[model samples]
Target: MDISKYIDYTLLSPTTTERNIIDLCHEAKKNKFYAVCVSSSYVALAKQLLEQTSIKVCSVIGFPLGSTATPSKVYEANQAISDGADEIDMVINLGFLKSKNYVSVLKDISDVKFAIGETPLKVIIEVSELNKNEIIKACEISLDAKVDYIKTSSGFSKGGATLTVVKIIKKTVKDSIKICASGGIDDIETVQKYIDIGVSRVCVSSDFNKKKQSI
Candidate 1:
């Protein structure tokens, strides 16, 4: 399936170091993965390391937790863009969504999308936090935000991406926003499953990093 281009090689830990990012980018360059996802603090470094390659530098805003205020997320997004981030993955306000306060949730994503203007925005809905209904509504809100992708998890939740959640998100977004299945995803089989079901991207982390190169 040429899964390499659909993967976002992620190193989003708080303790992630410059050396780690350098090595991660080097691996990404060699593997030709679609992008290298890192915390916003390292966007400049990643951009520098990947300057001459087609590999993209993706930065996360508000990260594993989406409780940050709208203004804060927007500020981070703007800073990332200024630092040369090619893509922005922002956590959605799960608290607001659970509270049935859809307005704030929509605003949070919309404001960041506006700040990062034209840069692809992948809104993480943290599927593990919501029940079936909330997941569907979150997808609807994301479609309205008009972001480029609707990502399933933050990889820090009790559970990560599930095929069930992916199916729901896929059926809901349906040709509107691209689906990004992350979290527990680990191998070629799961990756292919998500892609077959209409997911547009895969956020590969620990599982991908541990593999002893197949090529």
Candidate 2:
């Protein structure tokens, strides 16, 4: 199904070096993947490397942990955009959501969305950290925040994306917001499962770094 087109071709580890990001951009461009997702700190470099290509550069905000203050996430996302990131994948404040501080959660996402100004905000709901109902609530809150996409995970947690959670998120977001199921996604077979279930994007992370090369 030409799954390469559906890949985000990511590298978001604490130890990701400059050379690694350069290599990642090269691979994404060569493979014709949809985008190259990297930490915001590397956004400028990835942008410079992929300036001549149509491949988008995605940057993460609030990263593996969503505990940071909303202003921090907003600034990070804004800076990433200024650095040439085409999309912002910001993690949701699970603490706020868990505490039923839905208002804070909504503002957290909305503020970032406002900061990015139409540069496609993908709210990482981190489905693995929430239950079925919480996942649904998070998706609904993301829709309210007017985010362009509701991503499943951060891939730095104990749990990762699952077909079950993807289905649940899809049912909630429907067509109002796009679904991006990330984490633990690698093989063509696994990726195809997400596509078949109507996921708009998948972060093909670890496997891509491993350079599986072929689906």
For model 1, how does the per-residue alpha-carbon lDDT over 1-215 read when each residue is reduced to its tens digit?
Answer: 58898999999877888999999999888888999999998999999999889999999999879999889998989999999899999999888999999999999999998888889999999988899999999999998889999988898989989988898888888898998898988777888898888888999974575672752
Query: Against the true structure, what is each candidate's TM-score?
Result: 0.97, 0.96
Error of 1 at 144 (Å): 1.3
lDDT of 1 at 198: 85
Backbone collisions counted per model: 0, 0
Q: Where does candidate 1 have its weakest 10-residue lDDT segment?
A: 206-215
| RMSD for each of the candidates | 1.2, 1.3
Q: Using alpha carbons, what is the TM-score of model 2?
A: 0.96
Against the true structure, candidate 2 has what lDDT?
0.88
Off by over 4 Å in 1: 212-215
lDDT of 2 by residue, 8-42 (tens): 98899899999999888888887789999999999
In model 2, which runs have C-alpha deviations exceeding 4 angstroms? 209-215
